[model samples]
Target chain A: MNWKTVLRLVSVDVKSGRLIRGQRLRRYRERRLFQYLLYGGACVLGIVIGLGAGTLYTAVPDPDLRTLFYEGARLLFLSFPIMVLIYSLIFTMMSQIQRMGVRSSIQLPYWLPITWEEHTLASTLAHLIGVPLASIILFGSAIATVSIYLEAVPLAILTIFALVASAFLASTTTEIFRVLQARLIGAVYKSSGRAAVWVRFLGSLLFLIAFYVAWFALTSGGGSIALIEMVASAQQAGWFVPYVWLGMALASFMNGLLAQTIIFSLASLLFILVLFYVAVKLNAKFGLYEPPAITVSRGAYVPKVGFLGRLGFSSLEAAVIRKDFKAFTRRRELMYVFIMPLVFILMPLMQYSGIYGTPVTPGSSRFLSAWILLAPGAIMAVMLGTIIIGEEGGSVWLFFSSPITARSLVKCKYAFVIIFSCIVTLVCGAIGILIARPSPDIAVVLLIESMLLIFALGAVSLGTGIKGADFTEVPRPRMVRPLTVLVYGLLCLVLALAIFSPLLLHAVAMEYIPLPVSLPKLDLYVAISISAVIALVVTFVFYKIALKNAEEFLIKAEI
Target chain B: MILGLIKPDSGSVNVVCTKAEDDPVAVKRQVGYVPESPRLYDFLTGLEYLDFVGDIYGLDASEKKARIEEYLEAMELEGREGDMISSYSQGMKQKITLISAFLHKPKLLLLDEPLSSLDPRSARIVKDLLRKLTAQGITTIMSTHVLEIAQAMCDRIAIMYEGRLLALGNMKELRQKARLPGSDLEDIFLKLTGTEDVREVVEALLK
Candidate 1:
């Protein structure tokens, strides 16, 4: 429709990630240069590598070896389109998932005088420009440059065209699916009514699981190259499938089957056009639609002190804890935070279950079990700790205006992180125990280490979050400053390692090291005791820091 | 600064008898504030949100419930209090914000555009409620763009232009200061703010 409008919209989406760099550096020219640098650098690297390979290829004067090189290169080039298509499809779809929130990557200006087709096309093109575009440019440059020496420039040209077309095909398909996902989620919410919160959570969790499952299945065995080879073989047998048509077209062209190439290319073109048409229509129908409000509760005007008092929290602290819990469970944007740790835990468990073709050996099993027991809870602690205060976003004024002391703020937030982390640890440890059957002593060690890391890292991140919470919600919500997150993650890693080192050394000493006759034996419990003390000291120090930061944050409300 | 929502840059700040810098929480305890644009927790139902705020202010269970229910009914939001605030319209959200400011019954109220997004009935109710609260010894500091509301509702009005107070007094005193003794509050405000050349700006724009 409106080419100028579409390009303008696409530019915004392309540079959306840079919007979180803070308010002062909102200059468009700088962002545009940065965006260009990514792709341009990739292209340059690709070309340099191609030139080196081309020079080496020409120097290999042996006819048979050269012939083999040509054959391998031909196979790779033929399959490149389908490979790009799958990558483009999966990445674009994953990006689309994040865009499902109220503040999507590009907030479509629905109130503006732009048509649906223009908006849909702009989104599709924008999604393509990041990973998918970089990929095509890199591979396309290398293949096209190397083709000069291979004496197959025409075929490389054809393959490149097919690659670009397939990327569009995948992106347009993702656009359709994105709109469909919104419509389906809305429908489910409407029909479920009172149970909307639970239904939406489980439904989205299942969807996320299915997406990962399909992704792992596709890239499981020998990775993308193997998958590409499989797809290349399958293309011939499954020529009727339109997804593989672009690859088949290139294959046909390489085999000197001009007629077949024309037919397959035309079919591929038609399929993409049809997908585009359907996507545009879907966008027109539901792009501007708002989902119905989810009703979690009804018919109540009662306030209770609740069971949090039993846990020794003040009313103010308990109220904040309950509110944060509801926010996590009920808010769609926050649901991802809850599901991510579960998914991280599930992945290894799936491997242990032999679902991913990895049988659990006793050695591997113990390590996996330890990982399951220790990692997810600590990771969740760190993540939730950093995001807890920042998740208040614009609503932070409530804390400022209320009579909440800094100590109460830190105490409540820290308590929530600890409680949630403990729950995750127990759940994951239980599953790991069921699957791996780790020895009781090791299980105790794992659990203790997990709890210690959670306590220590939770305080560290909470302190970091308080100091550097980013309340920017436009485009999308950025909980903490990127630099702060980086430093916090590094510090957590170092702290976790320090806490785990004594126990790890004990394990190593007992299992492998010869006992020095001069040294006294180190007991397992002794090492765990040392770790617990270290964790407590770290927690206490950081908890105090978090309190200080909270005081400053409370006083500096943007109100 | 009075509510301790922000730290004062140069001046010493006090709320009630507490110095804000020394004890912001104590200062906050004595003050209830509704910002210009209320950014509320949309995930919680209105009742849950109000309850949370009540608890934060250390309201007992029965008192919190009674106050929340009374305010909801007063604001015509009784039936809808159970719905998540994300589901509420702008007016409903503004009403909830107003009720939150009033829920704890602090000694002082700081409201910015308190009647914004309110229906006429809700606005009237809030105006009457504010007057009642004032009579009962609760101090109100309200800021609004509507001069009529300020002229009608305020005991002492402060006319601010560009973050500086241009004038401060009751209506009669302000009328005298502007030297337009018979003029309405709008003209007096314009004259005091030195933006009385409204005709010239409009004429330039038309040309």
Candidate 2:
């Protein structure tokens, strides 16, 4: 087995993939200022953390400080492996989910006269996926060192060792998952429509729950049972578990138990070797599993049960919208983006639950809840809107070929974003209203505000996306130019303030801000009427402007 | 320019009773284009892509199903319909692209390097399919660098040099015009387009 060749090949492939191309160079240049600012900010923050750590360790005579950092470093070191595993598995799953385009014709690996046992799978798991993940997690490890700087100076190399070990375990775990996926994906796909997706979703959920439970159990020291006792029991129960060996090694080293440390350390190493062997064996198994043939007529289209797909749109627009929705749902990387809006929706409920511990009566809090819902909904709508055409990857020509007017296309994209955002908002609002028990008045107000902003935000973002989109690029920018972003931000801000002018005017009347002129505040009835008019006006103006701008850009694009 | 992906600087394109500038939707509805390297959504399976195309063309549910089934079998893409296009071989991808283009039953079918990656058998099938489609009075335009294929298939061949059509005619007409009746399309193309004699160039390349 030519292990060296496998290692070299994996390294070269991963390194080359990271190399920016001519197309990306332009984008990098465009983001140069922002990149510099971010890097600069990180450096400054690191310096600050370093100085703060030194100050606390040396000057702070408090006993709690000593115990706090000691415990903090202990937890960080122990949970570091779990964090690495979660992140690595999540990313590998995402990449697998996002796999698109023809298989790259780089058949160099196949040409190598070596079997999977030649450390090919190991190198791929460790280098292609593992090395990049380790490199990313390295940044977090460095930041973590700052919090435990007092001890990092003494056990610096050992801490680095543990962090590196985390990366290896992460890759090994991810390789295990990959083998299972490769074997089961075909069967899952054939079982029922979206069976693979459902299985993957459930798998991800279980993993996340396990991760959260482990973290919570490890961190929580309160209640009738202590974390130490629970962990002791688990450790005893899991004597054969591999990861426990690392922890035992660390604990024994801390306690100066040389014999125990050596035993646990050797056990950890032994398990890692076993894991690699299993990974190679599984890769071979994965290679051998051929998917049963799918009859073309029966397998052509699997119509999704999503709400958006059910809304029959213009055939062309519907297809485009459906594709966007499908891409969003199928791509695991997009799971975060989809979940973010829902979390925002639930924020008010969480706050309410915290405050009253029961359903709250209709009051000022209902308006606050409504604002929370709209705020995230607006952001979600805009972010979703901006990607409509840009996220088409290499399929931009589909739009260009359609002969559908740019205005019509943009409008459809805007509508899709609006529809999706509304669905999220409505789900959140219903839950919030159920828990918070807002009055009919507040509910009506929430509905009206959501509808107005959804349309306005959607149009503005779709316009911005179309105007700045470079059709030639693949995996197009998720964001607009920084300068354009500022413009869009200002437009969104103005519309938002106009929508909330009644509240703002009332606040000003109540002397929240000292205005140059003491303008008399109108009644709620009058204020609401005026704001609704302004919202309507803003929505109409933005929609028209966005549509017209999109038309011009589409017509002028050189393709 | 014809598909509105780009704007024309000095000319106009009109096809299928629709002007390119007038209404892109109408023009697109009547034109099925297969670019030299069509950038398909690789994330989609063969069937999904065809279905999407069917929807884009506004095909009725039953009609789309029948057409998709008929072509999938004809193109020999039956068994692998459920696989992601990313997993498809080049020849397989090309077959799927061809199937997608025909789903809409457009009036004008434009093909660029359509047979670039097809197997010999698949190539023959595509040629037959193109012939059948064109015989239905659908205007077919194909662009390829392979002179033999151009000569063998096209009723009227246009030899382009640096974007200019140096000569345009049927096989007999072009041969007569080029004063190379015994030569194939390559010689006639070279003579009319004023390309230098290639005997020495070919020998040098071999060496």
- Give the proportion of true interface contacts each model preserves, from 0 to 1: 0.85, 0.42
* Window of ten residues with lowest summed lDDT in model 1 chain B: B1-10
What CAPRI class is candidate 1? medium
Instruction: Give TM-scores for every candidate, taking all chains together and pairing residue i with residue i.
Output: 0.93, 0.76
Error of 2 at A82 (Å): 4.9
Interface RMSD of each: 1.5, 4.5
Tell me the docking grade of candidate 2: acceptable
Best by lDDT: 1
Tens digit of per-residue lDDT, candidate 2, span B1-207: 776556678788887767777776788889888878777776567887887788778787788889988888887877788765655878888888888888888898888988999988889988998899889898889999998899888999988899888888899999999998788998898889887568888999999
How many residue pairs collide in each prediction?
Answer: 0, 3
C-alpha positional error of residue A127 in candidate 1 after TM-score superposition, expressed in Å = 2.6
- Top TM-score hit: 1
Clashes of 2: 3
Task: Write down the lDDT that model 2 would get.
Answer: 0.65
